[model samples]
Target: MGESVAGRLFSVLDAFEDGGPAALRLTDIAARTGLPAPTALRLVRELVAWGGLERGADGRYRLGLRLRMLGAAAPCPRGLLDAALPELRALAARTGGHADLAVRTAPSADGILCLVSGDRLPPHATAYGKVLLAVPPAVLPRHTRHTVGSPGVLARQLAGIRTAGLAVCAEEFRLGEVSVAAPVRGPAGTLAALGVTVPTGVPLDRVTAAVRAAAARVRPPEPPPYPSP
Candidate 1:
């Protein structure tokens, strides 16, 4: 389908997905969106004027603080995440690994996903990334030798995740690494997932049970569609 006007606008913002706080040159935006340089420049300018994108001292583009504030207020699963934080922390503390609260990106035809991570991990091995990969053909970037490159295998893994109400990875996305995850449901319905990471040889079943127990206590947020222009 041809890009919707809203899609073009969002494409400009999406261009900054990996930029962190750094200002991106015109070429960077163009590369991220596969748009021509002239098109990227025009769209970026529009976003800046809207207070969604900003230019830095070096004359490169970044997400404005205004946009960051909006992101902070976005309503998807926020309530559940808040309720689950203490429990997630306890799980992480007891496990001495990593933890996260993840929600599937709305408007996609895919499996569950994570919204944030509690610690930095190899892009593939991180509990958050792997859960996204648990589904087939998810939008994710590879970051390690153990990353699951095959969509079919990952699809099977996702089924395991759904059936068991948990997912586990043992060197599937990295060497000498493993993790476990459980889905968190809200009073409204399922909204996000909770996960924990531990080194290989740890008992995954036990960790997954703890995450599930925590999820059972919280009410999740209603899944909302992405904002429209």
Candidate 2:
């Protein structure tokens, strides 16, 4: 049996679930999604026409604003995001603030893999991934020359993240991009992460403060007391 048309189209978008948060070439998409090159190109063209994908000047493709909006509406198994979207939006509206909520984080197959959209960035190289990842890896994947691949160094970073309740990555995954993230936890522990990506020298002190505030606001409201038996 062959894959459904909708599944094929979804596969193209799913291909970007990991790796650096960088625009992907058609070849990269094809290889990642396990689709043929021509097939990937055809699907990408349809997505671009339908506004589900955006192609940049460099001819790389990324999820379009429309697609992202739809993603925001998808069912959240934990219902945590229902309390977060508003705060995330407010944070994003500020100058240079790219706000996000952790979609999910995969098992530690490769020593703590971060999963899609927000999980697209490398855990060792981005603030969002770093905070969500509980254990530091023995060997970190290097996304750039500046990436912190040293396990010892990364352990210290993780320790700081736990202590400060935040993480900050400075051009570790890609030059000119900085990320700050904080964990959103409930009684069960981190339900998700909230973060912002901004450029260098953008007053990180202020951005970090804003992100922390937004994360705080995303806490699920207290449940009403049960009726007296």
Candidate 3:
């Protein structure tokens, strides 16, 4: 079957993804979406009318405010913040390190639901990102010499990470930053990750232990046992 109007419209938006250039001219959109000039123009205009895209003075288009607001309202982003903030705060206080929580994200044509992509780190390079990478990305971008860009090497590391129940990064993401993280599993599997970043020279012994403990404490709030009669 032929593509739907909605599908064509979304192709225009996806042309800006992969953290690519912020703006594109009409021809860029046409080429990216593989649509003819007139068709691309029509779809672009429709999106502009609906506030889903913005056209600047240079006639370049960019994702607009409406799309960002909608992305912010996704269920996983909201739920992860509510569920992990308390544990994050406590973990930071006890360890004297930067503590964070992240969910794997899945971006579909509509918006990002949380799964299938690393949200806060390079899945092949960071502590929390490794265990959360249930589906590895096709391309691995290198950030440092320590980054495991080779697929075979990363595959080997992932095996050990699962067995150990945590992943540790020693200047893998950046030259001086070090981190360790533990996965928070749900009935379905890993739902999120809790990570702590300590100074480069600090021993991983204490922070590693702390992150594992904190990850166990992070959980989504349960629904009420009974509805009102």
Candidate 4:
């Protein structure tokens, strides 16, 4: 390519975009982008000065507010969140539990993507976060002893979600907490997830079925894509 420096700088930014730490040290950025030490240091300094990244007190770098400001102005489907919010709220209200509509992010290695917290938020110890599967579990320091950490365990849970159209966690992710999640579809014909969380001892299957029905009610409007001619 023409300008290796520019490519490297963009790569550094891309590293952050792909779930790099909120703050990355010179070594951290180097490791994330596979850049040599000297190059990482120079690019990070430039990015920090340019307001694309910031060096924090601990000497780690993070995405700066300027990037976030610019990102927010980008266009996205307006109905994306609108279509999910009402049903999320209703689920929360009926279950007396937290509800979420989550989208999987393209960047992270995590099995799931993100959750839109609707009603009450589940305790950090619960699997609502796991069901949503946004950031890789490693990204967030372990918050609870009950958290299901292994990739194998999480894979199994996601399998269950695919088969049953929902996932349930009973005090496995948190103490005295339970969460159930169902998949939701979008206008673009993609599936997101809806979750409800409550204290342990609630009947999780009932909540799961209710959410599954709610997901069925909100059909995605996009026509299926035609195969190649």
Candidate 5:
């Protein structure tokens, strides 16, 4: 049987991946999608018309901003980022650091997906990742020289974080970077985390307080209970 149009379309989009080039030539897209040049051209033009893809000035194709808008509309348990943004902004303002919101997208995935971030930090080496990883040990791929590679040690560290109600990391993801994070709870459980990253020398006590306060301010909506039998 022939591949469905939808399947081919998805394959074309999936050809793009993180760390790959920002744009792909027509032949590159064709080869990546395993579609003949003619078919790929037809679909690429359609996608461009639909705003799912864009043709750059250089004549290469890239995923369009519309896709990002569409992806943001996808379901989240409790509108997590919307509820947390205010607090996140406050945290960044107070600490003058990178503030981020992260959530566990899947139990099997090794790391949390950042929903909103004020600055970039390696997920495995930051306080936000630690808070998200504390409950269930989804060991992350190492990204830095100081990244914790051992699950056993990470688990123990997470235990301490659970007790302290916050997580802190110093230069673990990148040299001279320090971060602190606290959990935002929902009716179901921990729905997301709030994090702030700063210079290594900044006093953590104030940052930790701000993070905790910000996390407390975000109240993820309660999930509707199951109907009683």
Candidate 6:
């Protein structure tokens, strides 16, 4: 059977994978999605008009910020962010660094999406990503030269995170940036990770303490009030 327009549209979007390039040329997108050049161009134009995709200054296409705004409204991350934002702000203030909340979008997905971030560092380079990666059903991706690339080495590191109830990354994602994170659990299980990023010069012990404390403060959302019939 022939593919539906909706399916083709999704294929265009899916060509841009998580942890891949931030932008792609028309040819790249067509090649990735296996669409003809004319068809890819038509769909890309439509997506751009609808704010689902963007055309960069260099004439390459990138995922639009609108998608991020929409993703933030997803029920799971939205609830976690609402519960954790206050503590996240306090953590950032205390540590003088970026604070973030991150969760796995799906059990089988390799990357954890940042629901909210107070800084500009890549997710894979931050403590928040490391904490989520430490948990089960997540596979780590090597994002930078500092990333822990070996499976055995990363396994040992994850074990330590589980034992200590916290995770730390020192310049693993970028030089001179250090991050610490702790898991935030809810009724279902491990729901998200709360993390802070600071310069490498900051005291690790203090940052670790602050991150752990902040994680502790995140409570699961209260159930919606029962509606009267």
Would you list the rank order by lDDT, best first? 6, 5, 3, 2, 1, 4
Candidate 3 has what TM-score? 0.70
**CA displacement after TM-score superposition, residue 18 of candidate 3 (Å):** 9.1
* Structure candidate 1, residue pairs in collision: 102-114, 102-115, 146-173, 186-220
- Give a tens-digit lDDT track for model 6, residues 40-89: 99999999999889898999997776776677787767888999989988
lDDT of 5 by residue, 1-229 (tens): 9999999998888776433354789999998889999999999998999988889899999777566455445567337778888888888999999788876544544445566632323445778877877443444556667778777788788889888889998878788998789989877677777888799899988998899999988888655578999
TM-score to native of every candidate shown? 0.62, 0.61, 0.70, 0.63, 0.66, 0.79
**Best model number under TM-score:** 6
Which regions of candidate 6 fall more than 4 Å away from where they truly are?
17-28, 55-61, 118-124, 134-145, 222-229
Stretches > 4 Å off in candidate 1: 1-11, 14-36, 42-69, 109-135, 138-142, 172-176, 187-189, 221-229
Give the backbone clash total of model 6.
0
Of 4 and 6, which scores higher on TM-score? 6
Q: What is the C-alpha lDDT of each candidate?
A: 0.63, 0.74, 0.75, 0.61, 0.75, 0.77
RMSD of each: 6.9, 6.4, 5.7, 5.7, 5.7, 3.8
| Alpha-carbon lDDT of model 3 | 0.75
TM-score of 1: 0.62
Give the clash count for model 5: 0
The clash count for each model shown is 4, 0, 2, 7, 0, 0
The C-alpha local distance difference test score for the whole of candidate 5 amounts to 0.75
Ranking by TM-score: 6, 3, 5, 4, 1, 2
- What tens digits encode model 4's per-residue C-alpha lDDT throughout 78-145? 24445666787888888888776555433352323233532222222344444455323543334466
Give the per-residue lDDT digits (tens) of candidate 2, residues 1-229: 9998899998987776554344689989988889989999999999999998899999999777676555555554235566777887789887466777764433432212222242345567888778877776555768778899788888888889999999999989888888888988888677567888888778887898998998888866555578999
Model 4 clashing residue pairs (backbone): 24-61, 104-113, 112-133, 113-133, 113-134, 125-173, 125-174
For residue 76, give model 4's deviation from the true position in Å.
5.5
Scored by lDDT, model 4 comes in at 0.61
